[model samples]
Target: MDFAGTDAAEKATYSTLTALMYRACEPIDDDTSVLARVVGCSVRTFKKSLEQLIRKKLILQLENGNLWSVQIEEELKNCNENLNRLSERAIKAANTKRNKQKDNSSREHDEVMTTSSRGHDNIMMSSSRQHINNNIYNKKLKLSF
Candidate 1:
C-alpha cells in the first residue's frame, strides 16, 4: 500500500484509533495516573493526542473509572476494514488501467507491423514491374537487331 495514497482524514482516524486502544489497556478514571499518562502521551504522541481522540469520540471514558475500555476499537476496526476495501479497489483500478494501456500498446504495434509489411510489398511489386519493363525493352532491341 502506498502511504502517499492514504488520505489525511484516514491517517488521522487511524492514529486516533490506535491511541484509544493503547489507552484502553490502562485504567479509566480521571484521577488515575494512567489518565494523566495517556493524556500526557509519550507513547505515540498520545500525551496531547489523547484529548484529541476523546474529542473525536474515538476514545471514551467509562462512566466513572480511571481506566479506558477502548470503547472505539470496534468502530475503528470497521473503519479500518472499509479503508482496506477502498485500498484494494484503488489497486485493482490501477491494475486494470495498466492492463488496458498494455493492450492498446500491443494493438498499435500490430498496426505498425502490418503497415510496414504492406510498404515492403509495395516496394517489391514496383521493383518487379520495373524489371519486367526493362526485359521488354531488351527483347525489342534484339528483335530490331
Candidate 2:
C-alpha cells in the first residue's frame, strides 16, 4: 500500500521482485544484474525490490550477499493480480472525475441557454408596440462559447 519510493513506486521494481521470487528455486548469484535484465528493468530498480523484500522479511540476504526467499513465493504469485486491481481502480476513479466535470459543465450551459430563451420570450411579449415605435430596432442573436 505504502510502496512509495523517492520518485515512483516503479512497477518495474515489483516486476523484478516477482521474477526473483519465481526464480528463487534456482541458485542465486551474488549479483542480480542478469535477472534484472530478464525482468526488463534496470539493475538499480531490481536492487530496490530486492532491498524491499529483505526489509519486509520476505527474503534473507546471505552473508555472501546472495539472495534467498522466505516462504514468500505465494505472495509473489499475487503480484499481477495486485497490479491489475490497482490499475482498474485508478482508471475508474479518473473516469468518474471526468464524468462529474462533464455533467457540471453541461448543467451550466443548460442554465445559460434557459436564461437566454426566457429573456427572448420576455422581449417578444412586450415588443409589438416597441417594434412599431422603432423601425430601426432589430433582435440580434447572441452566440456563446
| Predicted structure 1: clash tally | 13
After TM-score superposition, what is the CA distance of residue 9 in candidate 1 from its true location, in Å?
A: 27
TM-score of each: 0.48, 0.39
lDDT of 1 by residue, 65-140 (tens): 4324354555667777999999999999999999999999999999999999999999999999999999988884
Error of 2 at 124 (Å): 6.0
Cα deviation in Å at residue 116, candidate 1? 1.7
Off by over 4 Å in 1: 1-68, 138-145
| 2 Cα displacement, candidate 2 (Å) | 25
Q: What digit string (tens of lDDT, one per residue) describes model 2 on residues 11-60?
A: 55544554565766443664677867766677887778667756866557
Index of the highest-lDDT prediction: 2
